[model samples]
Target: MHHARSLTALLLTVLTLLAASACASTTPGTGSVPAASEDGAFPVTMTHRFGTTTIEARPQRVVTVGFNDQDFALAVGVEPVGVREFLGYPAPDRPWAPEGVRGKQLPTVGSQDLDLEAIAKLEPDLILGINSYIDDEAYGLLSGIAPTVAQTADYPEGATPWDKQTEQTGQALGRSEQATKIIAETRAAFDAAIAEHPEFEGKRAVFLLGSSAAGFYNLGADDYRTGWLTELGFDVDAKGGEISYEKLDTLDRDVLLGEGIAEADFKRDLVQQLTVVKEGRYVGLGAFDDDFAAALGFNSPLSLPFLLDIAVPRLAAATDGDPATTPAPYLG
Candidate 1:
């Protein structure tokens, strides 16, 4: 009886050890333990101009502090939890966001002002900001709440190339591959469109903002307005002088693109003084209404395709002089 009892006790001890071993093996950081695979989707660590940030998990809740940042987030297939409203722009109230993120529910976080309190309440995993919209002081505050990224270059804070900015933000979010694909796809679409209608070839074009208050604002090459136009095969004219809110009595170009200029304004005596106007070479782009300017305000990788769709057709028409006469498309 004693021998049998000893064997039983030993067997029970062995069973307990096995169970403990199994538990340890399943737990992380054990030598014999099975590791939980990241399933090829590991969180990324991103270092930007603002500071270092680690995204422990893919961000589902995001907040955009600037107009373009919001667009970039949407391009990567995620709508922001919060976004800034653009004043004096057509931001239509809708069931979802009005533009690129049209189907997603998003809250307005106020315009041109960073709503830290509102952002904190949303409990976002990530925040997107441009250098112009966010400063170092703001960055320190935002980083405490969530990982934030700022633009690489300095351009009036909110102005950066949509492609570069999108690429940077996507990398931070562990969606670099997705960003690359989006860019390539967009370029492909532009190529296809240009092939279908080749009237945008070798034509010099200028994008100007016409304001009753400020006469004209010619977009520089670095500006988003003319940058995209340059991409669409429009030769951007160079204005070497300092840019300011000034009226010009002369206009010279194969094509002239202006937003928010009334037909009556174009017909005014002031407009007739311009050489291009006298020659009938001016092609006023009435499409640059409130909605279009609002769209421009939020230029991002996601919105690039849409902008191309709108601007390219009109530009091609303006440059070629006729809808049917398709010129050779710009290859550069």
Candidate 2:
């Protein structure tokens, strides 16, 4: 649900196009294979939205142009030379970055305002924009600088699932087997969490970001934040089509998650009309909390473990269907 408003707009525009075409089968394209070395690595080709980019050998100098691409790279044992700077927040550090990268001085690439000159100066052998908005022009430029990998062409812009990004990233870096293991372990963690919280099974849930002016906004099915809930065995209810402000009261589900809702807005008559709110099944993720926002934006292997710790118990308490019980405190 990172940038939920912008993400929803992109999804609506591409939903019909995606439905018409069978892009689900459009896995990342693979090009020519490199001669395997004793390590069983190299010359790998990674297919993405832009086109097939071949990495002749294992890349030593890497740069990540996407918001969380650095996290993905670090999780797989590579330290990027440069990473995209997170806007709005004062600092650029990610809470879930591995210990090795926590204090390292990684140069910054602009997200909203890209610094092509800075990226060029880094002289990276591999450029990862896998989870970012890399247009044809940017791709051409970045590819010229180094082999560039953009988001999956099949999925809508900015909507590439995190797991797909992670897998593709690993492939590009000649670490497919390691990436697969990381993904399996993350999935196993989710499975274990589900096994522990039997109450979350088949429970209807909705994730929302609320404000006084916009009311409550649903992170639609396409958003990874909601998708993660579905992974944890919750039946997530996503807004299929545009639900106007007036019709917000009609949103029905058992477990309601509200992010960034002010206490005053919670007291509003219209907001209180929702069934979940009336039943005291709403879990409030604090507006000022940085960790919650970071989890929504960066659902990577390193971050998912932290997210599971917070999300499972709150979801369990919310869906228990008991008005007398309240969820544990939002630890994040």
Clashes within 3 Å, all models in order: 3, 2
Residue-by-residue lDDT tens digits, candidate 1, 261-322: 65565566666666655544455555444445555566655455665656666565556554
Clashing pairs in 1: 132-157, 198-327, 199-327
Please provide, for model 2 over 239-330, each residue's C-alpha lDDT reduced to its tens digit, 9 standing for 90 to 100: 43444457776666778787777788777787688788888788877664568667666778877877777777777777776887877657
True-structure lDDT of candidate 1: 0.58
What's the lDDT for all of these models?
A: 0.58, 0.70
The global Cα lDDT (0 to 1) of model 2 is 0.70
TM-score of the candidate numbered 1? 0.72
The alpha-carbon deviation from the true structure for residue 292 of candidate 2, after best TM-score superposition, in angstroms, is 1.7
Which lDDT value does model 2 have at 273?
83
Instruction: Mark the regions of model 1 whose C-alpha exceeds 4 Å error after superposition.
Output: 1-42, 87-105, 154-156, 196-199, 237-250, 262-264, 273-275, 278-280, 287-289, 321-332
